[model samples]
Target: MSNTPSLTANLRSDLPAALVVFFVALPLCLGIALASGAPAFSGLIAGIIGGIVVGALSGSQIGVSGPAAGLAAIVLTAIGSLGFENFLVAVVLGGLIQVGFGLLRAGVIGYYFPSSVIKGMLTGIGLIIILKQIPHFLGYDADYEGDQSFWQVDGENTFTEIINALGNPSVGATTVGFIALGILLLWSNVLSNKGKIFTLIQGPLVAVAAGILYYVLTQGNPTWGVAPEHLVRVPVPKSFDDFLGQFTFPNFGAITNPTIWVTAFTIALVASLETLLCVEATDKLDPAQRVTPTNRELIAQGSGNILSGLIGGLPITQVIVRSSANIQSGGKTKMAAIIHGVFLLLSVIAVPTLLNKIPLAVLAAVLLIVGYKLANPATVSAIYRSGWKQFGPYIVTVLAIVFTDLLTGIALGLVVAIIIILYKSYQNSHFLHRVDSDDAAGRHHVQMQLAEEVTFFNKAAILRELDGLPEGAILELDVRKTRYLDYDIVEILENFATKARDRGIDIEIIAVGKRVMNPPSYMKFFDLAPAVEGH
Candidate 1:
């Protein structure tokens, strides 16, 4: 773990980064809610809780939690199966389950994910972001902003949606998106190096401000003006009382339902897995390479989900997009995430109308830059150079994610990674060499050294080597360096001793640097017979 900057000391950097994340999260919160078929305000509530509560408790400095697009389908189904109020009960129970998972140290499950898969996940998400944002950038708001699934709820797949956007591009939105992109590129490549002014005020904030100004100046011009439908849609309340009325309480009476329990477990498992994965990815993205305590992250996310459910918000999980945005924007502490939540809370109550005035295209442009940074060609090239064993899983994860969904893609990637591991294990179980090729009497002398740990997976390789030994051969089986010898492998050696007798082959078993001629038995030497019999 690396030290995180104190909130007071990191404020200057965190503040600007927070603003950038706020712009990116605002629409995502609403869009995920929309896609989930939940109340629009629920997403906002989740964003606030995820930022304020989870940020405070999480060990992560850069991870940002909110309503994730990955859970949209689950939420939609859960809400439809159980009524909205009953679903809230499930969310609360799910939070409790997540907290239990943290206490049980289930977070260690995250460590099993291969590094190639994690890298693939980041790159896959980057590609998804770019593909999903294209339509929004072209002013075609047919699909929700944060939808990451290849087949969208809007009756079109990722590619089809992009095709549609190309056919019907909005002039005003397109112009503004390109302008925002240009400004972002300029600020990043040129202006930011000029002085402290560019550093203090983020490019995203500037692009948003310019976008609002453009929208205002061209509202009446049909050709150049962005439509109202293409703007951020925050649920605005008519009065302070109405604002407070927005919060919906869960149906405590429905807690006894078995369906609710099932939903709760599903949400808890999925949310915990997503949070753990994001923790790994965020740690990798951190310039300081700080390791976040995974169990603590689970508890933090669980707490956030609890509060979110109580207040009619969606389930919370650490999201990579916002986390990456925080890192790329130079955030040095969790305060950046917390403050972004505060911005969300204050914005809905104070100036939602103003937020609604900003074009979605501008935010789309911001995400475009973030996506490019995540899925850059350099990252792919580096992974490819690591060798096919690594690159296979990395590319598989990327393609699966782009073609399917997040969890499914990760599952497939893990399968590929496991197969690769087995393949490597089979090939590297032992080292065989011909010692002093053919002794004085022309007898073949072969030495086979066992690996540090030899399991049943290595049985085939060892078997092949033993069967290839010629008649009248002198064989030395070395176990001096081996720490673990599986019963299956020992059995193979025991069975081979019988054949060695018929073939006129001499067998020498070396253990602890001592050679035993015609050893009494391999089963007794390795002491694995009883363990295997017990099983």
Candidate 2:
């Protein structure tokens, strides 16, 4: 399939998807901003830059970018340790490093990510979203927004928080969360399927609208009145100047701060890794199976973070939550992603007050649906059915990510994948079979056929096979299918050939390049034993 696209070709599909993404992204942006311990407007700024700048420059058709929940902990720590103004300088510096990474062709690293690990990453994030949102759904509001790490900013872990939330649940928030969840389920299954009118009217939008209406109606009631802390808290600017004043500028003087530079480098490395992983996952999720240019994606992300930092925004990355929503909503091109950004800009500029009126529990319900789709039981079972080669890494990645950070989880999964590859290589380096030709020489023919590739790892296996060869045997060492043979393996075969002659073994080398020999002079050159010497 062609990688390029016409803007208008997917307009119908893209437009509806963009609306859905906007509705999904709005709360996340505000929530992530609140989580980062930064001004609320900063999250919106990042959302805008990610959508408009990255969405425009990126080669990914459906992947969406925004201030990510994954980066919330890092941002929070960075701001607290480096000071908010200095952290802004770090974000800008991190963006510059990402750009350099793109130029260095580091994007090629994305291709090496294992597919099972990618799926596990998606599944792991989904499980984390679900786990992290439970307290919010119950309106506990103890931990700040966008806190997904197992060890929360609060002293409690995820399970402990859930237990605590159950002990002290809010009646109003629970009611809103349940009602919103119902509306989301209904819209996804019934009304949204009825016709075009309902398709464009997304489930989350309706859920948010319903929650806001409920909040207003129940304001004075004793049983259902929602607490102020449980509600969303967007900065309600009094005028245009007040809105502009909310934007914080980076302090260029922080350039000399070594901690800022270290934080910047850390952010750049982690952000780049997350972006590459998401890009890989999103491409897999795409129905058309289009490949994204990983290098261009880094450039887009770099540009977005640079602009976002200048305007006092949180760090941005390619977010799977919004991207998966776009795909599920039938987005066919990058236009949907860009249009969602446009909505984020217009919403803050035009209706920040109305947006602020929405309840956090409602957004939690929407995210719960996304989480369920990602970590469905069927997906887990299917991966298991693929066998341990896939399931081991898949489960390990999920567990690691759920327990640790995204990069660590992926790294563990990759290590497992590499181990499996090495094990398989060691297991299947060659095939040894015995055949007898009747009425010929009345001799047994033992054929050793080489595998497609051989490396130093296969030396022991080949040596064992050679040592097991029977005396006076008619042996055939075949290398016809071998594409790669390590020097150690060649030396083993050459040394074995010398011993075979003494043992009265008829060894016929087949398809091996050049006569393999243990040259005494060559061995002396490296101060090693000659290949022809007996062990």
lDDT of each: 0.93, 0.84
Error of 2 at 456 (Å): 1.5
Q: lDDT for model 2, on a 0 to 1 scale?
A: 0.84
Tens digits of per-residue lDDT, candidate 2, 1-535, equal: 9557787898888988888788778868887888788878898889888898899999999999999877888898899998888999999999999998998888988999889999999899889889988898998988876666777777888889999999998999999999999998898888987998877677777888899999999987767977878887767889989988989999999799999999888888888988999999999989999999999888889888888899898899999989998998889999999999998888888887887777789888988888888898999999999999999999999999888767788889999999998888888999999875632656667889888778888887888888887777778767667666666776776687688878877766555343323233322322232222221
Tens digits of per-residue lDDT for model 1 on 478-499?
8877877777887899999999
How many backbone clashes are present in model 1?
A: 0
Deviation of model 2 at 278, angstroms? 0.5
Query: In terms of lDDT, which candidate is strongest?
Result: 1
- Model 1 TM-score relative to the real fold: 0.97
Candidate 1 residue 35 Cα shift, in angstroms, is 0.8
| Alpha-carbon RMSD, candidate 2 | 4.1
| lDDT of candidate 2 at residue 478, scale 0 to 100 | 70
lDDT for 246 (candidate 1)? 91
RMSD of each: 2.0, 4.1
